[model samples]
Target: MAGRAGDRAPKARRIRLGNREVVTEGLELSFWADISHRCMTASWPAFIGGAALVFIVFNGFFALLYWFGDQPISNVPRGAYIDYLYFSIETLSTAGYGDMHPQSHYGHFIAAVELFTGIFSMSLMTGLIFARFSRPSARLLFADNPVISTHEGRQTLMIRLANERHNIIANATAQLWVFKSGVSKEGVPYRRFYDLPLIRSQSPALALSWTVFHVIDEASPLHGLDAAGLKAANVGLGLMVSGYDDVAAQTVHARKSYEHDQIRFGHRYVEILRVTEDGLRIDYSRFHETVEG
Candidate 1:
């Protein structure tokens, strides 16, 4: 029912980092080798369904063993496969009803093994569930596109992000890096990374939204580079933000990447902060919207 690696389906995976798609093949990963990682990353429904399937298969396997034995169970009718299956379920779950039980020595040995397996599996499942729920995660929302426009009489590249949780992130720090592909003087191809300096990279407490600005001056790596020039050079950008979350009591980090084509030249983000009758409000509906400058 399964094909070899060379048959047709090669071991390949397509991973999306930012807007870039990278294809990797020939990685022979064993499912059992990374079972814990796979289970932890799996969706709620998938994880639960897989656990249920395993439980059923385990009981079914023991049921066949009980069916082969001579008078394995007392209350089960002779030649009734379903009754043996039901008895197997009861024994494996440790829900032994007095009505059905092991009668022969062979049945007793199988039931003993099933009881041990039931206890071990239930403990493992409990640990996995606890680990999944205790994992730390961030709720940072990044704008879809980075905009370039004039700010403070200089061309500026701006990226906006918000705290979806509306909780304080203390000592939040941000970094921006630009990636460019070029040929070395020795005629070798290479991709280089350059840090882009932001106007203000640190915040005492980030509660709502923050806009980071990188002025493209003569000293800047992005200076004299238009959208077309960036694309020609195969330029890309990555942003990283990290801080201690007061609510979660842990350090959380978020990252976003933008390809050259996703960069918007001569554009600015729509204003989202406004004064309301009650108080100052931030309209996040237009957070990702930009207008031509």
Candidate 2:
């Protein structure tokens, strides 16, 4: 009876990006089953470390093979593991200095194998490095929290962002989405997504700062949502910005999400722009700062 009950139990879902939950019903394979994708998507340190480890391990394996062979390498000190290891490195890198050459048939076979492996490994590493370096990324800085404040005599939801690189992003576009738990008319619980219409979603040129606003009017999805109501509904907001980076000559994208607790009611962003004697100035220290509305 216990086994049967366990089998009937529903699996827990995970929320990713706003309130999007992944349904795992009937799923057989885990996402981690693919190692190549993981390596490609892993951090820089991890990828580089893995590459170094592979190089060391491959060289060590070849060195052991040479050490076990019978007088295979010429001019290598007898029974000297270090000499064998150096020979292995030279063979694997195709950097034969001609000082130490393979003499026996066994030595030539091992050298050929190591050389082939070296070429393949080097090509794979070069492709991965190129892919990682060529990938396009954006450096947009989002405010720590979203604020609800008065804008144009109406309450509005606002999120601020700044270009950390201070480079022009041409035809930059932004979108705001709201996610909340809701009950259907049939009393079934489900997550809902609402596209919040922003007053200005596109900027011709985003060089410094941009503030996006969604007015909370009668037609707005958050028309009557107060702080408590938002919290109770497990509200989340997702913001996505994409633009053509003139400097990079590529399309760059950025995303940010704010949970219910990170949404501030009746607050306004602190002023960050100022005119200085030298030129215009932007104080990033106050980028995430806010004041009571």
Candidate 3:
């Protein structure tokens, strides 16, 4: 059997964002061309390990250069690569320990180049650390699954999210979108996107839980879609939330995605908020709980 048209395309990479892994094809970029981006996105352990490896490789290269030179340093030990490596470390770090001093012009030149490289690398590392620390991130928690049930005499779709940081988010806004695979009039296969209008998509101050709702009426894009229908069409849903974080003093955004099977129909979220004698209390333990409507 012949393979699909997309299978014949040159595959480039798979990138994961939110809950989707997008398959990109027909193009690729050189690693050096995007080194900065790669570094910024790398995990802390991986970044530190890579930096350490580079440091060792550079010091080893300089140590080899010193070993080939004739009596470049005044160290007592002769023909010792370990001693030369120690000297390279001291020079690269600019420690200038008087015990081992460069006595030849070749040694001085190598020391000078290593010193400059060390200074430049330290400055670059400092900048990268500062950038990573200053990057704004959202601590928003989303429910594992969305629910569909009757609300105010209409069938509705609902998604729940909370501010896990417990900080005020001013002028918070939300958007919901759906993707579905279909064939156009000309019989061309395509994936189409549609926006689902929500009843209340904005919150003046979101510090706790918020549930956005969308009535699945005749005008809605998901008006008549059932579980089987959604599965057959390969439907996917995405939710995006953004707001100005009062504590961080910057705009932060969060997003999540749901596959067709993750939607729970004929169900509603369990109550988590109650009025106590002191004030109001929320039971986060029940936040993700849902029951049949």
Candidate 4:
């Protein structure tokens, strides 16, 4: 007996947007498997819509249950689904109005169940909303493209970013990484990553703009790589900025990536800082503006 031909081939893995690698061959897990976390992390509109839908559906279901029994809710109009629905809402919210309420053991049991569901659901939704609002996120803005230009009489790789928030971000740090395809000494093709050394990667405070520069000298992996070479090798430059935001009172991070084509050679960023009669003025309209070096 021999194994199947398909089984002999190794599975190919795919790198996703967030650098997450997934094997092509595997048991695909259902999103419902981790529904709690998914709900907590879901977008604002999605989470709110889901909660609204659940609330309506739950009331509708209980209304139908009340309609099935004889006079489950006292003072509700005879055979009126709408009236039963209203009663269900009141019971679920524990807002027992004097006008109508549970009239029998069956009614009491159903109301009890709805009350419990309402409490638990409200608590879960409150926690998720608070988590989303409290999460720390950086508002750093990166330049549209990276540039290569002359700096201090040497060719340098430059990237610019600004802290959009007026508040201070303490102990800010940045890192630049380059990913490119290359052939190993053994003639095997592989993807390689290199950390470019920056002139100044750390900042005590970041309230305005910061320009990061990496000297492309002999020590750099990109020393010999020209624009054409970079394109041929499928280069990608990744920039990461992290800092402790005073206003947020927590660590926040932001990242951006530029492809080979997005790197402009012999180019420099335009000036964005200027002094006005009132005070310092930053023209954000020209933040991404550039000029040929």
Q: What is the TM-score of each candidate against the true structure?
A: 0.88, 0.88, 0.91, 0.87
Give every collision pair in model 1: none
Cα lDDT of model 1 by residue, 6-73, tens digit = 68665689977777898989677789999999999999999999999999999999989988889888
Model 1, residue 282: what's the lDDT? 91
Please, what are the lDDT tens digits per residue for candidate 4 over residues 197-256?
999999999999999999999999888888899988988889999999999799999999
- The predicted structure with the larger TM-score, 3 or 4, is 3
Off by over 4 Å in 3: 1-12
- Please report the candidate that would top lDDT against the real structure: 1
- Candidate 3, which ten residues in sequence have the lowest lDDT sum? 2-11
Question: How badly does each model clash, as a count of residue pairs?
Answer: 0, 0, 0, 0
lDDT of 4 at 13: 53
Candidate 3 clashing pairs, residues 3+ apart or interchain: none
lDDT of each: 0.92, 0.90, 0.90, 0.89
For candidate 2, the TM-score is 0.88
Candidate 3 matches the true fold with a TM-score of 0.91
Segments in model 2 whose C-alpha atoms lie over 4 Å from true places: 1-33
